[model samples]
Target: MNEFQRISPQQAQALRQQGAVIVDIRDPQSFAAGHIQGSRHLDNHSLHDFIRNADLDAPLIVSCYHGNSSQGAAAYLVGQGFSQVYSLDGGFELWRATYPDDTAQSPAE
Candidate 1:
């Protein structure tokens, strides 16, 4: 697709269960604190490797602090040849509130 779609937390959760690749674009500290389980922390340093190795046809979800930034990131991923790109509507804040149990924490790497 040439564009990305916006999805609610519920929709994102479903996609997650189905093995969608979820990437968080927040700062390292914030991302290390908590994020969707199995989500990868994508930053400038990792962007190139990520895009190079990702499965373009697989569903991909982009998330940011409150959702706004994710829209732009999602669009960029779509432009990079990701066929199914989605931006989380309410972002990490909503996901944390909606599915607290589905989140994970780790040291920033």
Candidate 2:
């Protein structure tokens, strides 16, 4: 089994610009409050669908509230055959603070 790498929010942002797929593992309410722009919410409810539909080789970045949980999520994704999985180091809080303009609230919320 391969381990996922931990990257700073700035590195994650660079990955995003290169078309990495970002997935937020936070609860629905938290995710609805704000998230990285273009990130997909992949909580327990939607994880299965996402896994089934997502390309296995795509660069996948996982983020949680404080970055801790995202490490586990990133590992899981890598185990599921995602070739390039990364855990965002500072998660949503860091991202929000670092690049507020790159964040977006859930429009459907």
Candidate 3:
């Protein structure tokens, strides 16, 4: 596993307020169901394929369903020259559970 840094929900929320890009690194099918408002979707399963077609200059906040995939995404982003990159501390499940009213369930596949 990579030794990248993670940001807390509150910290993610704060950075989000400043226009950071929350990159939901789940499958497109999962993300289309539900996502943080304005989050960009890029499935972590194929980061190498999807990354080449992404906006790399923005502040990135990567997330998976439970924070696992995000570590890889963060590390990948760092390697691609992303200086301000972070993985959500607990992923989407935690985010939704923590902010119950703030988010909704993802669509079923």
Candidate 4:
């Protein structure tokens, strides 16, 4: 689509189960401290590589500390050619609060 869609934490979880590529745009330290399990950390350094190798048509979920920043990130991903892009509403904080058991520390394997 032309823009990214906003989704609640529950919606994000559902998308995760369906194999969406979830990317966390938060700072490295905060991301390392805690984040959604299976999410990849994406910053300036990794953004290019991630997009270069990513499947442009796959569902992509962008997340941040709060829901606000994710929207812009998601939009950027869409502009980069991602077909189905979603911005996690309430972001990591809400996801953490909603699914406490679904979080992981120190990044994903």
What's model 4's TM-score? 0.96
lDDT of 2 by residue, 60-99 (tens): 9999998999999998888888999999998999999999
RMSD of each: 1.2, 1.3, 3.7, 2.0
TM-score of each: 0.96, 0.95, 0.77, 0.96
Model 4 CA deviation exceeding 4 Å by range: 107-109
Off by over 4 Å in 2: none
Model 1 per-residue lDDT tens digits across residues 1-109:
7899999999998998899999999999999899999999999999999999999999999999999999999999988999999999999999999999999999656
> All models: lDDT?
0.95, 0.91, 0.77, 0.93
Q: State the lDDT at 76 in candidate 1.
A: 91
Note the residue pairs that clash in candidate 3: none
In model 4, which range of ten residues has the least summed lDDT? 100-109
Model 2: ten consecutive residues of lowest lDDT: 100-109
lDDT ranking, high to low: 1, 4, 2, 3
Clashes of each: 0, 0, 0, 0
Worst lDDT run of 10 residues, candidate 3, spans 100-109
TM-score of 2: 0.95
Judge candidate 3 against the unseen true structure and give its global Cα lDDT, from 0 to 1.
0.77
